[model samples]
Target chain A: MTPPEPVETRTTTPAAGRSAQTATLAEIAREAGVSAPTVSKVLNGRADVAPATRSRVEELLRAHGYRRRRAEASRSPLIDLVFHELESAWALEVIRGVENVARGAGLSVVLSESAGRLTPGRTWADQVAARRPHGVILVLSGLDESQRALLTSRSIPFVVMDPAGDPGVDVPSIGATNWQGGLAATRHLIELGHTRIGAITGPSRMMCSRARVDGYRAALETAGLPVDPALIATGDFHHEAGYRQGLELLRRPDRPTAVFALNDLQALGLYEAARELGLRIPEDLSVVGFDDLPVARWVGPPLTSVRQPLTEMAEAAARLVLDLGREEAPVATRVELATSLVVRSSTAPPPA
Target chain B: MTPPEPVETRTTTPAAGRSAQTATLAEIAREAGVSAPTVSKVLNGRADVAPATRSRVEELLRAHGYRRRRAEASRSPLIDLVFHELESAWALEVIRGVENVARGAGLSVVLSESAGRLTPGRTWADQVAARRPHGVILVLSGLDESQRALLTSRSIPFVVMDPAGDPGVDVPSIGATNWQGGLAATRHLIELGHTRIGAITGPSRMMCSRARVDGYRAALETAGLPVDPALIATGDFHHEAGYRQGLELLRRPDRPTAVFALNDLQALGLYEAARELGLRIPEDLSVVGFDDLPVARWVGPPLTSVRQPLTEMAEAAARLVLDLGREEAPVATRVELATSLVVRSSTAPPPA
Candidate 1:
C-alpha cells in the first residue's frame, strides 16, 4: 500500500504567510497609484490595463503571491452526488463509500436528494444545473417517468443506484441481486423444514420489492409448496409497517411458522411483534431478513439475513457515475452484485 | 399534528403528452421562424439575444407550455459536507438530518473526506470553490490549528461539528454534551449501589472522549470515591478495541464490578469480551454506554446508555452553516445539546 500523503495546510506555505493580512483592491489601487476600478479590472484579468500599470501590479502580485490565490480559486473542480433520500442509516454508508472514491479521484461530491424540494421541475433542474458538476451519481429509490425524462433531457452524465426503471436512457446503474437474495432466504427456511413460510415485502411498485417477491414465489414453487396469497403482505419497508403486517400474520389461526422480510428494518418490526405476541424467535417462529445491515449482528438472537455488499455497491456506484461523466456517448450499463445468507440464531426448524 | 406531505411523482399532463414526444428545439425554432442557436440562446435568456427574439421565444414558451428538461449548467448554491471518517451506522442519521435541512433550503450538499486525497489543499479548495457552494459543514472528530487555518484562508463559511477547540473560533459549532452524558452514566452506576467502577474510553485526542473521561472523573469524585487510573483503559471507539480493553480490565485482579464505555461501540466490545470470559451482563459485570444508537437496544442485554440526539445535532449543524452563508460578517456560535441516560438490562448492583 502507498504511504498516506500529507495534508496540505495553507498556513505552512510561505506565500500565505506574506499575504496573511494583505489589503483589498482599494488598498492595492492606492499603493499602485491607480484607480480602484482599474486595479479591479487588472485583478479580474480583464483587458484595457495599461502596460505600465499591468506590469507594476504583476510585480506587486509576484512580491505578495496574491495572483496565486486568485488563480487557485478560479480553477476549482465540481462533483455532484445525488441521492433519492437520506432518511435511512444505509444511505450513510453509501455516502461514505462515495466520499472515499470521490476523495481518491481528487473530486468534491455535491450531495442532492432528488426527492427533496427541488422536484423534477425547471426549478430543480436549474438549481442542479447551476452547479455545473463534472458528473452526477444518483441514488434513486424509484423515479417516475417524468423525472427520468427530465434527467435524460438535461443530458447530464449520471449513474443510478437501485433505479426503479430500466435506465434505458443510457445511465449506468449499480444494484444488488434482490431476487436471488430473496430466493436464497426463502429456500433457506424451506431447507430448515418450514412448510408454511410467510413474507413481509416492500412496496410492490419498487423494482427491488417486486424482484424479491418474485424470488419468494419461485422458491416456494421449486419446493413444490403452494404459494399462498394470504401469506404475502406488503409494507412500506418501515418498521411500523412490518410490525403491523407481522401482528396480522401472527393473529391467524393457521399462522406461518416462518417469515422472510425484505429488509432489516421490517425484520426488526417483526421481532417487536413477536415479543408483543409472546412468541420466542426460532423456537416459536423462524425469521429471516435481507440487507444484513450493521445492526443485524447486534440484534437479539442475531438476525439471519442476506448480506448485501453495501460498501462495494457504493464504491461501484461512485465509479460508474464518475466514468459516465467522462464518456461522451450515453453508456447504459448495469452491475448486479451478489448476496450471501448469514445464518444466525434467527432461523431454526419449524415447531412440531 | 401536521399531516405528512404527499410523495412527489412525475405523471405527464394530458394536454402536453403528445407534444412532449414530438416537440424539439428545431420545431420550436421553426414555429418561431428563428435559427436553432438563436432560439436556444433566446430560450436560455442570453443577453446576447435581440429583444425581439427574446420576446418571441418567451411567447412561444408560454403558448406551448414547453418544459425544457435541464437548465444550462453553471455554478451556484453548492455546499460541501466533510467527515473525518465513516465507520458506524449512526452516521447515517446525521447525514439524513443534514440532507433534510439542506434540501429544505434548496442547497445541494457535497460529501468529502478530510483525510483522503481531497484533504485541505489548493486542489480541495479549488474543487469546492469551482462549484461555488454557499457554505460548508465540516464533521470532524477534531480540528487542529492547521486545519482551522486552511478554512480561514479559503474564505468559506463553515460550521464545525464535534470539534476539539474552543468555540471561540470564527465559525459556528454544534456538539452533544458528551461530558454531561458521561457523568449521567457513571452516576447511574453509583446510584445502583456499585462502589467499584471501571471505564473503557475512546481515543483521548477526541473532544468527546476527553469530555466523557472528565465526566466520569467528576462523578467518581462526587461520590467520594478515589479515581483509579488503573481501572480506565483507552480504546479506539471500535468493537475490537473495546473487546481487548474489556478483557484486560476484567482479567485484572482488582477488576471493577461495573464498566462505563464512552460510546455504544465500545460497550458492545465489552459485551463480547464478557461473553468470552463466561460472564453474564449485569450479573458478573454491569456496563453502561454513551450514544444510545439503534444497535444499543438490539444487543442481547439491551444497553443502558446516554442518548445523544444525533439527528438534532445534525439539523443544528446544517442550520448553523446555512445561517453563516447568509451573513456577511463572521459569527462564532456554539451550541451544546444535552443528553440523557436510559436504564436498560445491562446495568445492576455489584456482585456479592
Candidate 2:
C-alpha cells in the first residue's frame, strides 16, 4: 500500500487552511483579480482565458484547491452518503435534507451504511473509491486514518454530519446545539417548579450525548443545585435502555419529580416504564425528551422535547458537503445549528 | 441533444431478450461447453483461455448478455437504490436490508430519489447511467417506457422492489403479497366478530393500495357482508389523511366497530381521531394496520398489524440486483415475499 498521503489539515498548503470558511466562485475570481466568468473559462479551459491570467488562476486553484468539475459534458452527478445506521427517523431527516440540495444541484445522492458498524470499515472506503463519487458525506460516523487518506487520495471531499465523535480539528462537520438543548430541557422542568430532576443520558461515548449531559449539569448548577451523580443514569438512547434505566431511576426512594431523556426514543421508553409503575405523567412525574422526532407529538399527552433542528442540520451538512466538493471552495470546518424547546403536554408543575 | 437509440427489448438483438433473466458465468460456461473459470478468463481477457473456447464463450456471452463487467478489477462497485421518497420507517427498513446484502457482496449502495417527485422523474435514469452502477433497485417505484429502454440499452439491469405500478412483462421486480396482507388484516377483524367493518386505503394510484383494498372487499364478501362504499374512505397513507378519513367514517351513526388502516401511520391517526371523539381502542372501536413499523409496538395499545416483511423484501431486492449484475444469473422476473398478520393489543371483538 502507498504511504498515507498527507491530507488537507496535515499540510501547510493554501488548500489545507481553506477549511476555515467556505468561499464562492466570485471570491475566487476576486482573489485572482479577474472576472468571475474569466475564472470560470480558465477552470473549464475555454481557451479564451489569457495564458498569463490562466496561470495565475491555476496557481490559485492549486492553492485553494476548490471543487473543479471533473467533466462538464458528462460527469457522474452522485455524492456518496454513509451513515452508521439507518434504523430511525434521524437518518430519514438527513436524507431529505441532502436530497433537497442534491436535486437542486442536478446531482443524485447515493446512501450507504458503514457496513453494519459504527464507523466505515476499510472495505467501505474501497467501495467508495470504486464509485468515484464527486464527494462523500458521513452521518453520525467518523473515518479511520487510512479511510481518510483513501478518500483524500481520490480527491473525494466529505463532510461529517452529527459526527458521533470529535472528527478532529480539520474535518468539516454539521451539528446541532446539543448543550443548549439539554440546558433548555432542564430549565423548562425547573421553571415548572421541579428541583429534584433526574436525567437519562445517552451512551457517553457519543459526543452529542455527552454534550447534552454537560448542558443538563450546567443548568442544575446555575440553579444552585448540587450536581447529583446519583440522579444521572446512563442509557444507550434506545427505548429498552430507557425503560431499564428509567426503572432504576423511578424505583429509587428519592426518585426525581421530573426527568430529562437524552432522546425522544428514550423518553418514550420512560413512558412505558412509567405506565408499568402506574405513574401518571406530569402530575406524578414530568418528562422532557430531545430530538423532537415526529413521534414526540403523537404519543399520549404528547411530549415536551428539545427540538434539534435535525432537518436544518442535515440541510446545512448537505450544503457543506457540496461546498467542500468545489475547487477553491472556502470550507467551514464546523457548523452548528440552533436547538430550541418545544413544550407540549408531557410536562407540568410537580405534584402539589 | 443525442437521438434516443432504439434499445433492447425493442430490437431482435440477442441483448434484447437478455433482460428476460440474468444468467450467471456458470450458466454461460455450461452453455458454451467450458468450465466456469475458463469463461471468466475469457471475459477478463486472460491469456490462458483457448482461442476456440474464448470465441465460443464470447458468442454465448452476447446471446445471454449477462452482466458484462466493464474492466472488472477497476469497475465501479456501487449499486443504485432509488426511492419514491424516504420519509418513513418503511424506507429505512428497505435500506437496512439492502445494506446487509451489499456489504457481503463487497459492493456499496448508493441511494437516489426521483428528483423530489413521487414518480421516478425523467432525469433519474440519466443520473443512474452517468454513475454506471453495477445494477439498480427501485423501491415502491417503476420506470417509464423510455427510462426502461435507456437502462436496457446500457445493459444496466434494474429490479423494481414493491412496484407501485404494473412493471409489465419485461421488467423484473420484487413485491409483497399486499392482497394477502389486506385479506389477513380484514379476516382477523372478521374473526373477532366484526361485520360492520370499515377500510381506509392508500392513494388509489398505488398498486399495493388497490390490491389491499380489493383484499378487504374480498374478505367482507367472504363473510357474507355487503361492502359499504361509504365506509371505504380514501387516504394518502399519511397521519392527517387517516385522521380526516377516520373522522369521516366515525361521525356516521352507523360507524364501523372495527377499522382496517392500510399503514401504521394512518392507524396512529385513527388513534388520534378516536381519542378526539372520546372513544377507546379495542373498546369503543378496534383498529388494524399494515406495515408493522417500529411504532406499531410502542403505541398506547400496541397496534395489531399485517407484517409486510419489508426488510425481507428489501433483502430479496438487493439479492436480485446483484444477480442481475452477474454474468449468467438466472432471471426471476418478479419476486413476492409473504405477508402475515401480527395480533396485538389494539384488536378485540367488536363491542356490543
Candidate 3:
C-alpha cells in the first residue's frame, strides 16, 4: 500500500482579497444596513428576522469572509452526518462508521437524510449553522454554492464520502477505488473464461457508478474482448432495476454467460432474475457484484463481489472533517481507499 | 383493528404528597446550600458542578418532582434517538421511521448508540439534558433511575421502543406482538406437516426474545406435541449465532424436519448451515423466521416469516414521545402493534 500522495490542486480557492484579516460582526451588520442584534439573530438562525434582511446580512458575511472564533464555532458537541437517502443496509454501515469516530472523540452524531435529493434543503443548512456542530460529513451528497458559502462563513468544515457528483477540486473527500474494483470484478469473470460478459451500471449521475463501468470497458479492451454496448444495462443501483435489466440481457439469443452488477443489491436482483428464467448459477450464469455488503455472503451461491471499505471510508471522512475544523490551513485532500475482489460460490467457469 | 387501550397502570409514579405545585428554583438552591447560579449550572449539565453538590441537587429535584416549564424545555428543534446497537438493517428501518416523523415535524434527529450497553451511560444522559431536544426516543434501550431523574428534572420526555428488559410498568413503550409473531411463524411450519419442529431463541435476557420462545412453546403445546427441550437452540439474534446454533440443531441424527428462527438474520444463517449439510430448503428442511426484513424476500427460496412493522413501530414511538412532551398529563401508554405471517417459498410440507 502506497502513502496518500498530495495532489497539486486545492479543493477550493478563496475569493480575491481574502486574507488572514476578516471583518467583524459589527462591520458586517453596517454593510448590510442592519442592526448588530439583527445580524446576531440571523447568525443564530432565529426565525424572527425578515427574509430580505437575513439574505442581505448573509451576503455581507460571505463577502467579508467573517468566521467566528474557534471557541464560538464549536459550541455543540456534535458531528453532522448527512445522506442522500437512508435506504438499504448501505446507510447503516456509514452511520456506524461515523458513530465510531464520534464516540471516540466524545461527540454525538446528528444524522439527516437529503430525502432522495442530491443536496440537503436550505433549512438544513440553517439548522446546521445555528447548532454550530464541530464538522459535517456528507455521503453521496454535495452542497451548492450558497450552502457551501454559508458553512464556510461560519468556519464549519465538511468532507464528502464517495461523492455522487464531482465535488469540485477544493472539497476534501474520501472514496473507494471504484475503477479498480470494477476492473477486478470484470477480470475475474474473464479469467473464468467468460468472454461475453454483461454489465449492469448504477445511476449515470453517480461518478462511482461511471468509474466501475469504465473499468469494465477497460478490462474488456485490455483482454482483447469485444465491449458490446447491447449487453450493458442501466440501473439505479436497486434490486428492481437489476432484475428488470438482467431479464433483458438474459433473454437475448446471444446472451452473456456472466454479469457484473454495480452493487450487491443489484446482484441479488440478478439472482432472482436468473431463478425466474430457470438458469442455474455457474452452470448457466455467473455473477459478480460490487460493495460486498453483509448479505453478499448470505445470499444463495454466496455473491462474489468487490469489497469497498464503506465503514472505513466513513471513518476517514469524519476524521478528515474534524481535522479541517481544527487547522487554520486549507487541506485539499482526496483520499481513495483500496478495493479488492472477494471470490465466493457465485463465480465459476462459464458453461460451454 | 382495536384502538390503543389506556392501561390503568401509569409509567412513572410521583412520590407521596406530590401535587400540581412544584418547588421553585430558588427554594431548591437554598435547600442544596448552593447559589442560584450554581444550581442553574447543574440543571444545565455543566461540568463545573462539584459531583457531591450535583448529586445532592439531583436528589432534591427528583424528590420534589421538579419539572421545567414547557416554555423553557424545548429550546432545540431536535429529537434524540438512542439505540442499543446500530448493527444491522433493522436499525436502518427504525432510523428511517423516526426520520420520517422528525422530518414532518420540522425537526432533525440526534442519533446515538449505547454501543451494546442496555442503557446509555451517564455521559449520554448529561448530553441529552444539555441539548434539551423536543423529546427522546429510546430503541431497545432504557434509562436508569438517576438518568431518568436527570431527564425528568429537565422535563425531557422519552419513550422506549421494544424494551430490551422489563422496562418497569411505568415506562411508556411501543413494541410488536413478539409472542404473536413467534406463534405465527411456528404455526406456519406446523401447518406444513412438520410435527418435529426445532426453535431458535434470541437472548433470554430480553423480554421480547423470551416472549418469542414462550410463544413457540405455546404453539407446540396447543398442537398436542411434546415440547422437546433438546430441539430449542439459543441465539443472540445475530447471523453468526443462527449458523452456529443451526449446525448444532441440524447435526442431530433425529433433527427436526422444520426450524423456526428467532429473526431473519438467523434464518439466513440457517440457510447457510443447511447448504453446508447438503440439504435443500423446503424440500429437505422447512424454515420460518421473524422480522421479515427486505433481505428475507431477496434471499434464496424467499423466507416464510412473520412481518414485524419495525419502521411503523419506530414512527409510533417517536410520535408518542413527542405527544408526551406536549401534553401536561401523564400518559400510561404501552402499544403492541400487530404482527402477521408472510408465507413465501421457504416453508413447505416436510419431506417423507
Candidate 4:
C-alpha cells in the first residue's frame, strides 16, 4: 500500500469543526421539522416520503455531517459495481476482478452501467441506498456532490478505479501507472531507432489519458527528440477512432515510421489501417499499444504493449472499499499498481 | 417468440398427483417435525437453522413439490446472472443485455460465476434463496434437482441461456440456431470450390458444440463430398485448443484447404497457427468461425464467422424468466434465436 496522501475530508467532520459527528437521527429530524421515522424512511430511500420533507432531511444530514453508525445486519450480503459504460473487454477484466473479491467475501456483486454518463443517475443512488450494499466500486466513473453526500449520509463506502476525470482530492481510488507505461512504451520505440514516431491518444478529459500523453512528451524531451504536434492524433479509445486516426497519420506525406496507440483496441485498428494501405508491420511501420489486452497477442505479428494490471487494480479497489466500511480509521486514500512494457513483434528498428 | 414447446413438469405437481401445490408451510413444518417459523427460516436461507433440520425441511419441501406463494414486496429488486465461467468477451455481451432489461425494470443485476462447474455451488443457491431476486438467468450453466427444487420452493424462476448441456425438458432455455449457422458457414466454403474442408469441434458433451459438428457433417453429405474423419479436429472452444488442434490438422499429408473453426477465439488461434506455418489466410488456408465476437472484425484478414446474437439471446432469457415469475400460464419452454454468417476477408477460393 502506498503511503496515505491526505484527502481534504476523509470523515464526517463538520467543515468548521462543530462536533457534527455527534448529531443523531432524532436531532436531525427535529431540525428538519420531520419525525424521526420520517428521517429514517428518507435514509432508507423509501419513495412514500414527500419530496420537500426528504430534501429537508437530506440538507440537515449534510449540514450536520451526519454519519450512520454501522449495523452489519442491516447491510445486504452484496457489493455494488458501477461502470461508466459496459462496452469493451476492458470492462470485463475489471468485472472479473471485483467478482473475485466479492465471492471470497461471501457477497454477490450488483452491477450497473451509467450508460456513458460519468456520474451514475439519481435513481442509481436511490437503489444503492435501498439495497444497503457493503460498499460500491465505480470504474472510470465519479459521483456528483449530491450523490456523494447521499452515500456519505448512509455510511455506504465507495472507491473509484482508474478515475476518468479528477475524482477530487477527497476521493479514494485505484489506478495503474499510466504515465510510466507511456514513458516505457515510447522509450522502447526510441531504442528501436525510430525518431519520427506518431502518437494516438485517448480522450483528453481522462486523467490516465492525459498522463500517458505527457509521458510520451517527457520521453521525447529526455531523449533530445523534437515533439511534432502534427504527428499526434486524438481518439476516443475505440477501434474505429484508432482506424480513423491511424489513416490520417499514415496518409500524410511525412508519415512517421512508428506509432504508439493509446490502447490495444486502437493498436489493432492501426494494424487494420496499415494493412489497408499496403504497409507491412515492423517492416514499413512499427506500432506499440497500451493495456496488453488478450487480443494483442492473437493479432497477426502480435502487439507490443504496456500491461496495466486491471484485474489487480480492481481487486485492490474492492478490498479498499470493504476495508473502508469496516475500519474505524482511514486506510490508504490512493494507490497505483505498476505497469510494465511487454515487447513483441509489433516493434522493430525503423527501415533505412 | 417461438411456438410453445411442451415441458413435462412446468409447475409444482407431486409425482403421484396428490395436490402438493396446496401444501402449506405449516403442514410442511408438521411433516418435518419442525415449527412453522423454523420452516420459514429455512426457506429464507437463514444461517442459524440446524443442518439436520434444514435438510429434513428441504427433503419434505421437495417430496411435496412445494412452491412458495409470491409476495412482490419480499423479492429484492435484483436479478441474478450466473455463468458457467466468466472467461470471455461473450459474457460481457450477455451482461450488457441483462443489464439493459434490469435497468428498464428498475432492478439491478447480481452476477455470479459457477467457476467452470456446470452446476453452481450450493452456497450460490442458498444466497439466491436468501436474496430472492426477481429471477435467475444461468448462462451455460444448469441447476441440479435439489438446487432447482430449492429455487422452486422459494418461488424464484430461472431461465438458461445457451445451455451447455441438455437443460432438461422442464427447464426454460434460450439459444441461437447453432446448427444452422454451422451449416451456412460450411456451405459458403463449399461454394468457393473447395473440395476438401476441415472442421474443428468443441467439447462433445455440450449440445451447442455437438449440433455445430453435426451441421458440418450434414453440409458435407448434402454437397456429395466424402467426409474425412482425419480432417476433423477436436478443440475446447479456446484459442489454445484451436492452435494445438489446428497444428495437428494442418501438418497432415493431405490437409484440407479450408477449415471451419467452431468459434471466433478458436479461429484466432487457427490464424496464429497458419502464421506460424508460413500460411497466408484466404490464400493458403481459408477459415470460418462462430460467435462473431468483436475481435472477428479487427483480426488480420477479418475472420469470416457465424453470428450467434449472444446479447439478444441473453435479453430474451432475462425477459422470459421475468415473465415466468409473473405469468400464471406457462410461456414458451424453449426458444432458439436465428444465427447468420458474416463473411469477411478470411474465406476465399482455394489456391489455383
Candidate 5:
C-alpha cells in the first residue's frame, strides 16, 4: 500500500465567504499574552511551566480552534497492552515478551485487562481511551461493532493477541500455531500407546481453543481412531476450571487413560483432581498440557507440554505496532509463530 | 473546599473571535442542505453513513475547521504500565495487582520496561513521551536528571511505584511502609532470641533497600543489642545475589545465627545457599523474608515473611492518577500503606 503523504503543519487561513481562520498556537499565545513556546509547552501537557500559565493557555486553546500537534508526536511511541484478567501466572510470560521488544525498540508499554463480567461505563475501552495511548495490543475476547468502530474512527492502530473470537477487523495480528501444537500434543499421547485420550479445552468462544479442538480431532482421525465426543470437556482456561473438568472426565464410566489440557494452568488443575482421586500422573492417567509456563518445572513430576514462543511473539507484536506507527502506510499483516513440545515426567504409557 | 457552581451544560461554546466558530455539525448540515441529526450521527464516528457521504462530510470538516470532538472520545481504552527491565520472580505479583485493578476499572494495560543500561536515543523517557498515554504508571529506578526532566516536561500525570530516588517533582505516589516493614522483620528475628542476626538487602540505590537497612539497625538498637557492620551485605535483589551474599555471610569468622532478607526472592536464594552448604533452616540457621508472594508458600519449609498489601497499593495508585485527570483537583497527595508479618516454618529460635 502507498504511504500517505506526510501531514503538513496545520494552517489557519480562511477562503472568501468562510469565517475567520481557525485559531493557531500564535493566536492562542497572543490571546493569553504568552510566548508561542510557552503556549506550545502547555498544550503538550508539559509540567515545568507555572500552573497559572498552563491553565491560562489551556483555557485559550479550548476557546480557540487551536489543535495541539506536538503532544501527539511526543506520545506516539507508547503502546497500550490489553489482556483479559485471569490469573497473572500465564499472562506474565506474554508480558515479558512484549516488554522485551518494546524496551529494545525504545518504546514504552502500558498494561490493562478486561476481566470479570462485562460492565458498562467502566469498560476496558473507556479506560484505554481516557489514557489516549498511541496504539493498543488487545489480548481479549471479541469486540462488538460499536467498539471496533470507536477505534477505527479515532485512527488509533491496534494489534490483537490470542483473541477469543474472530477479530472481525482487518488489522495486524500475532499468534501461535495452536492447531499444530494441539495435534503434536495428541500425537505424543498416541505414541505412548494410549487409545483412550480425553481432552480439556479453553473457552470454546476463543479462536485458539477452537483451533486446538480441531487439532485434537485431526490427530485422532489421522490415526484411524474414532473420536469420542464424551471424552471432551470445555473449561475457562483457568486452573479451577481445569480441575472441575478433570474431575468430571475422570468420573466417566469409560474414562480415558490419557488427558490433554489446552493450557498449563488447566493441567495443574488436572494434577490436583487426579491426586484427589488416588491417581498417579503417568501410572494411572497420563496428562499433557500446553504453554510451558514457569510453574511447569516446579510441579511434582514436571509437566509435559507444548511451549509457545511467548517472548518472541511479544517482541514481534511490539515491533509490528512500532512499524505501523512510524510509517503512514496501512498494511494488514498476520504473523503465526511456531510451538515446540516439551517432554517431562508428566506423561507416560498407560499402566500395563 | 466549596464545590464549583454547576453549569447547565459542561460544553462551552466556541468563542466568537475564533474563525466562524469552526462550523460544527449543525452549521455544516445547514450549509450542506441536510438535517442536523444526520450530520451529528455521521460526525460521531458512526459507520452507517454511506462511504460517499462520509468522505464528503470529512472533506467539509477538514476545510471548515469543523473539529470532530467525538472522534477523540471513541478511541480504545488502553493504558501503558511501565517498569524497569530487571526480571524478578516476585514481579509477577506486583503486575497481577496492577492488572487486577486496571481490568476492574475497564482499562487494558500494556507492559513496557526500560532496558537495564541507558543507551542514546532509546531511553524509557522517549518511549513514554512517544506513547502519548492519557496517563502513565511508572515503576522506574536510577533515572538520571535528563530522563527525569523529559518525564517532567511531558506533564503526563504519573504515579511512581517503588521509585529508586527522590522524584523531587510533585506527583501522586504510593509506597509500602518499607522502613517500618524492615524494622518489624528484623525485630521478629531479635524477639526469637537471636542476638547475632545477619541481613541481605537489595541495591542500596533503591529507597526500599535503604529503608530496610535502617529498619534493621533500628530493631537491633531497640532490642538493646549492638549492631555489627560486618553482618550486613548488599545484593541486587535476585536469587543469585542472595545466594552469593548468603555464602559470604556464612564464611564470616563471626557468622550470625539468623539472617533477614529484604525480599522473598532473596530469601529463596538464601535457602538454596544454605542447602548447598548442608545447613537446615531453623536448625543450623534461621531465616526471615519480606514480601509473602505465592512462591513463599511453595518453598520446602514455607517462608515466614512480611506481607505488603500490593493489590491495595496498585488500586490506590490508579485512583490517585484518575483523581489527577479530573477537571479540578487538589495539589498532590502521598499515600503510605502498612505491612504485616506472616509466621511460616522458615523462622524459629537460633540453634542451641
Candidate 6:
C-alpha cells in the first residue's frame, strides 16, 4: 500500500510545461493516442501492451502524472462452491444466484465439481483448507466429519445447499419446500377429476425426491384415497430414464390417465414417449413436471409444473454461508424457501 | 508424506489376532455395521464422525486387521478454468470437456467467471496465486501484464481457449477454426440456391465474430456472388439480439430468401421472429446457424449448423495448459481444431 516509485523523468516533463497539476492518467490518454485503460496499463507496467505502444505511453508518462498504488489486502476474499456435476442448467441457475450476490458484495465466486462422486474426494477438502476461502457452499454435497473438522478448525464456515442426503441436525442448510410442491401438483390433478394418477419420483435416496414422494402420499391420504404401489415408479431424473419409465407406464393395460414427473427433463421424456405411442398430452393423458426449468415452456404443450425457487434458495444459501463467517450474524439451522404450482398447457381433465 | 502413527494396541492388537491376514477395510465393512468409506473415515480420523459410529467402527477396526497407509498426496492438483459467463450451453460444453480430461488425470477442475469483463479483476489473479493451481485455462479471456507476470513468476503456466482477441504470439492457445465454420455455414446457404441471403453476425469486436463474418464474405466470393453490405447485421450473440435483428431483416421489402445466423441461440431467435411474422421455416425463408448446440437438434424443424468442436477444443486447451506446467513438455504456439457443417431438417432450397 505504498506510493508508486519514481520513474525516470525526461525533457518533456509535465513539471516543465503543464505544471503537472491534476495530471490523472486519463488526461494523458488524449495526448497518448490510446484509451485511458491502455495508458493506465502502461503506468502499471502491465505486460499485455505491445512494445511499440508501451514506449509511446511511457513517453507520455514521462511528461505527465502517473502513479501506481499498491492495492490494500492483496489476498482475495473468495467463496468456494462445489457441486457433484456442472453440465446442466440447474447448476447454471445456482451459479447465477451466487454470482449476483457475490458480485454486489465485491467478492468473487469460485466453482468446482466433485466429478459426480457420491462423496467428495479427500483431496478437494485438502485444497479448500489450504486456499482458506472466506466460506464454502456445498451443493447437493456434504462433508464427512474429518473434512468438516478441517474447515471448522480453520474457522471457515460452510453451508449445505439442497442437501442430497440428510445433512443431520447440526448442519446449516437451504432447500425449497419439496413436499409442498409435490402436494400442490397432485392436488391440482385431483381437483381436475383425476383419481387414477401415476407418479415418477427421482432417486429414492435424495432427500428432495423422498420428500416429494411423501407429499404425493399426503395429498392422496387427504383425499381419502389409498396409495397404490403399482402407480408409483422410480426415475433417475433424466430424459432417457423418463422415456423408458414413461413407456413402461404407458404400456400398462391399466395405465393411469395422468402422469406426474418429478422434473422437467423427465417430463420432456414422457412427452417423447407419448408421441411414440400416439397419445397426445392433456388429450388422452395429462402430464405434470417439477422444477419448471426453461425447457418446460419450450416443449410442445408447455408442461404444468411445480416451480421450485432454485435461484432464490441458492442466494439464501450463499448469503447464509457468508453471514456465518460474520461474528454478529445469527446462524439459522435450516431455511426452506417456498415452491408453487405453475399450471401451463400440459395439464387438463383426464380422458372423458 | 509420512507413515501412519501406531495406534493403541490394547485388546485388539494385531499380534494377538487370529491371523490378521487378508483383512482389508472393505472386509471390515461387512462386520462393522457401516460403509467402507465410514471405516476409512475412522481410519482417517475425520472430525465429522459421530462418537457412537466412530467407536463402533474402531472396534471393528481393532477386531479385524485395519491398517492405515500414507496418502501419496494430501492436496488435489487443481486447474483453474475461467469463462466470461456460465449461463449458456456453450459454457457447459467447455466445462464438460475440461472435467472429462481433468477427472481422468486425477486432477480436479475449478471453474471461475470474470463476470463477462474483458479482463479478470486483480483479486482473481491473487486468489489463483494463493491457491497455486497446476495451471490456468482461460476461455475467451486474457491476462494483462501484471496478472501474467504474477503467474509466470510463480511458475504457474496458463493457456487460452478460443481467445476473444489476438493472444500475443508468445501465448499457447486452442480454438476452433471459426472462419472455416462461418464459411461452411454460409456456403450451405448459397448451395441451397439462395441468391439473396442475409446474415446476423456476432459482436464485431470478438475475434470469432470477425472471423465468421470474414468467412461469410469468402464464401460469397467463392460462389461468384457479390456480398450485400445492407444484408449483413451485427448481433450480441444472444437470442434477443437475433430476434430484434431478424425482425428487421424480415420486415425489409426486399427481404432475403434465406438468413444465416452466427450461433444457435440467434437461430432460435430467428425462429421466434418467423413465428411472429407467420412465416414457416424452410418454406418462406431458409435459415442456417453456426455452433451446432444440442438445442439445434431439438428445435421445431431442427436447424442446420456449423459444428464447432467446442468440447474437443476445450479438452485440448485443458491438456495444453497442464502440459505447459510440466518441465519437460514442449509448448505449441497455437492449436486449431476443425469445424464441420451438420445439415438437418430446418434448411431447404430458398422458398420455391
Q: Scored by CA lDDT, what does every candidate get?
A: 0.70, 0.77, 0.86, 0.88, 0.68, 0.75
lDDT digits (tens) for residues B139-249 of candidate 4:
988999889999988889999999899987778899999899889999999999997999889888788999998888899999999899989898988899889888988
* Weakest ten-residue segment in model 3 chain A by summed lDDT: A1-10
Which structure among the candidates has the greatest lDDT?
4
lDDT digits (tens) for residues B1-352 of candidate 3: 0001111111233433455435777778899998866767777666778999999988887887776655332257789999999988999999999999999998889999999999999999988877778889998888899899888777788899999998987788999999988888888777788999998888888989999888888998999988899999989989999899999999999998999998999999999999999999989999898889999989999999899999999999988988888864545479999999999999999998
How many clashes show up in model 1? Answer: 4
Best first by lDDT, ranked: 4, 3, 2, 6, 1, 5
lDDT of 6 by residue, B196-284 (tens): 88899987768988998899899999999999999998898888888899999999999998888998888888887887898888888
Candidate fnat values, all: 0.49, 0.47, 0.66, 0.62, 0.29, 0.21
Model 6 misplacement above 4 A? A1-76, A103-110, A189-197, A217-231, A251-258, A277-286, A299-303, A327-331, A348-352, B1-77, B104-108, B192-196, B282-286, B327-331
Candidate 5, residues A1-352, lDDT tens digits: the string is 0011222235433323434536666776788898877765543333358988866866665444343332243343456776666354566677777777765654556665455432122345534433445667776544555454444323355777776677754657888999999999999999999999999988877889899889999999999988999999989778787789999999888899999999887888888788778888889999888988766754556689999887788777777766655544434468889989999988999888
lDDT of 1: 0.70
The alpha-carbon RMSD over the true interface for every model, in angstroms, is 14.8, 8.0, 15.5, 13.7, 10.9, 10.0
Cα lDDT tens digits for candidate 6, A1-352: 0112232222222223335434455566777788876765454333468989966766555444342222223213567888877755677788778877776676666677877775688767755644546678999878886666555534467889989999987788999999999899999999998898889988887899999888988998999877888888899887777789999999999998888888877887788788779998889889999988765765556689999888888888889887876633545759988999999888989888
DockQ of each: 0.19, 0.26, 0.42, 0.42, 0.13, 0.09
The digit string of per-residue lDDT tens for model 1 on A163-268 reads 7555653446888999999999999999999999999988765788888889999999999999999999989777787789999999999999999989888898
lDDT string, candidate 3, A1-352, tens digits: 0001111111233544456535777777788888877777776666779999999999887776676555532257889999999989999999999999999998899999999999999999999987878999999999999999898876788999999999987889999999999999999999999999999999999999999999999999999999999999999999999999999999999999999998999999999999999999978999999999999999999999999999999998888988888864445479999999999999999897
Candidate 2, residues B72-137, lDDT tens digits: the string is 332356678888877677888888898888778867777787744556875666566545567888
TM-scores of the models, in the order given: 0.73, 0.81, 0.94, 0.94, 0.63, 0.72
Query: Please, what are the lDDT tens digits per residue for candidate 2 over residues A1-352?
Result: 0111111222222355456324455676898899877765543334356779967866665455454333322224677888887767777888888888888887777788764477887656655654456678898889987567556534678889888888998898989999999999999988999999999988787999999999999999999987889999989888888889989999999999999998998998898888889999978999999999888877776899999887788778777776766654654669888999999988999988
DockQ of 6: 0.09
What TM-score does chain B get in every candidate?
Answer: 0.74, 0.81, 0.93, 0.94, 0.74, 0.78
